[model samples]
Target: MALLGLDSALGATLDPVGVVLALVAGVFWAGYVLTSARVGQLVPGAGGLAMTLVVATLVVAPLGAPRAIGAFGDSALLGLALVVALLSSVAPYTLELSARHRLPAPVFSILLSLEPAFAALFGWILLNQDSGVLRNLAIVLVIIASAGVTLTGARRKAPAMSVEAAGTRRDDA
Candidate 1:
């Protein structure tokens, strides 16, 4: 609903194909989170991430390698690619794997939803993309929502642990 409202505010029509692609991306994201968490539990952090990246590169290389090779002649593009790989791929995966070890799956997933809000802020600041008040407010709301869930969820677990500890004390007594 917030998306639809934002779209309406922007005076933009929704593209069905784009919406379907977004849905597909969301499903893939969910899969990535669940699989990453399980993998993080089973395998060591950096090793699992390195294996995942190798597989991902192998999967994508056939399609992208030709174009990438052609573009490699440009030193600026090569530098950009290196920066992108470090910032967008390596850093995030490392942090995400570490987070998976520390956070519950649902909380991590809720935190992951903050990506769009951060993306919007980056786009506005970096790319000079849409600076409309409504769009900015929507991004703020997303950040607030994600933070609210994380804080409230963490608090809820505290009481349960306290209750369990209290029960254990009574049992010991």
Candidate 2:
């Protein structure tokens, strides 16, 4: 945030609603990591993911169904939407489910936080979207920090010193 010139919000006013929504999103994300991991463990293969997505679609459809129904009238648009859905939403979730099955929950969740950094990197490389130097530095810092944390979490407690190293040498120097 400091790198984004957020160190000083000279004229900024807090939006309570936005703050609440962001907090809510964070809580939901935490829940998602845990729930997804459990689901992955319980259901082998993509069966769990498929069932979860189906339920999610049913829950979400009411909100978008009307607009979605209209979108079907244009065959090309419908095709485009399907492509977009598969590429952006479904594929990532599938990969996440697969990852959740394999990785430790905390490591998996921490790595997921790198999504924005990777997205920005892709944008810079592929779309010619240059995040300014400070923002770029921030992204690099975040990646480094995430990696450090993940590795640190995986570390065991300090090992007991070998007797030769911890004890005095028997011979004179």
Candidate 3:
């Protein structure tokens, strides 16, 4: 709702299909994070990630292979593919696995919400895509919301931990 309101305030109309796709992506990302955390617990991090990439490649191959074969004739395109794969997939997945081990799920999810702001910044810097003032304001709103969630969550957890500690001490006494 806030996102929709922000879009309207920015004088941008939402495409229904794009909105639906974004929602669907959010669901998939939630699933990914939860499953990755479990997988990180059960299997060696790199091994599990290796298996995941292999399965992902197999799944994507039918659609991507034929197009890639045709496109791979261009050496520059091949280089771009390799760089994109490493930068977008390899580095991020590895870091995400490490983060999943360290961060609580809710906090992690809040952190994930900052991706759009980073994307906007990267687009501006790397692709020369300029977001106007209203759009930049929308990005700032997202960052503030994420920070609010994270700080509130941390405060909530601190009390719970202290309560647990008191309970343990009482039991020992």
Candidate 4:
């Protein structure tokens, strides 16, 4: 709340439009995380991600394409845009989905919860931005909570696998 400056006040937000929009975005982000796991499972390699990017582009292009098209006429601007997209969006999403595929959902979510810490850290280090005590405390709290969840929240026995499913006969081994 302190950062974007209040999805919630000390008691209430009074339903400000920015807070409402942010809440909606939060809900959509949660859905994206959940669906990204399923997409990783159903599609091999980056195919699912590729399809997602294409669909997202088609959906948003109507809003952005007219403005973006002019940039394409400049080789330097187009190259910078591609670089920014690849570094900021594509690579992170790819790695996030790859981790989501391997980790249990709870663990993945907890790990993702450290996003604020990472963002703050980057801002501090790369941009020389000062994060005040609240942000520092938040980073510490998030790390501790993530550690606790990893240690306790995701416990389970591995499911038994048949040898054929494991891709080897006992005799062959």
lDDT (0 to 1) per candidate? 0.80, 0.78, 0.80, 0.79
Steric collisions counted per model = 0, 0, 0, 0
Higher-ranked by TM-score: 1 or 4: 1
Residue ranges of candidate 3 with Cα displaced over 4 Å: 1-12, 72-76, 102-111, 159-173
Give the runs in model 1 whose Cα sits over 4 Å from its true position: 4-10, 72-76, 103-110, 141-173
Tens-digit per-residue lDDT, 25-60, candidate 1:
979988987787778778975998999899988998
The reply for model 2, stretches above 4 Å from the true place, is 1-20, 103-111, 125-128, 157-173
Better of 2 and 3 by lDDT: 3
Cα TM-score per model:
0.73, 0.71, 0.73, 0.73
- Per residue, candidate 2 scores C-alpha lDDT tens digits across 1-173 of 45644422433655778768978997988887788778877889999888988888899999999889988899999999999989987899988877877887567757876887888889989999877677777777777787777777656445656788766554434
Q: Candidate 3's residue-wise lDDT over 1-173, tens digit each?
A: 36545756568677789878989988988888778777788897588888888888898889878778966789998899989999989889988887877887767767787887788889999999886666678777777877887788778877555888889989999
The window of 10 residues in a row where model 4 has the poorest summed lDDT is: 2-11
- lDDT string for model 4 (25-133, tens) is 9898989877876888789988999999998888988999879889979999999999999998899988987887788777777788888888988999999987776
